[model samples]
Target: MQGFSGRFKDLVRRLGVTLFGIFELLGLPRVPEKKDGEGRGKG
Candidate 1:
């Protein structure tokens, strides 16, 4: 039904936002395996 689909879409959007925020907080923008001589130092 239309209502069910709408709810599902909203739920998925919320979950994506939450996961993205968690990643952002956990240093998602920084590369983990990069070394000092490359560019960015290790976190």
Candidate 2:
């Protein structure tokens, strides 16, 4: 039988990859960029 921890890790990895792919397809930003207050008004 496989170890519980190993199986859990594999499940988590799969979930992460799946979620990332979905986000990529939807054109969503994974990480937000740090913007300075000065640039707020400018497009």
Superposed Cα deviation of residue 20, candidate 1 (Å): 0.3
Model 1, 1-43: lDDT tens digits are: 5698899999999999999999999987886776668875488
Q: Highest lDDT: give the candidate number.
A: 1
TM-score for all models, in order of appearance: 0.61, 0.60
Model 1 spans with C-alpha error above 4 angstroms: 32-43
- Clashing residue pairs in candidate 1 are none
Residue 31's lDDT in candidate 1: 68
Local error of candidate 1 at residue 19 (angstroms): 0.2
Stretches off by above 4 angstroms in model 2 are 30-43
1 in model 1: Cα distance from truth in Å?
Answer: 12
- What's the lDDT for all of these models? 0.87, 0.86
Please write out the lDDT profile of model 2 over residues 1-43, one tens digit for every residue: 7799999999999999999999999888756776787447555
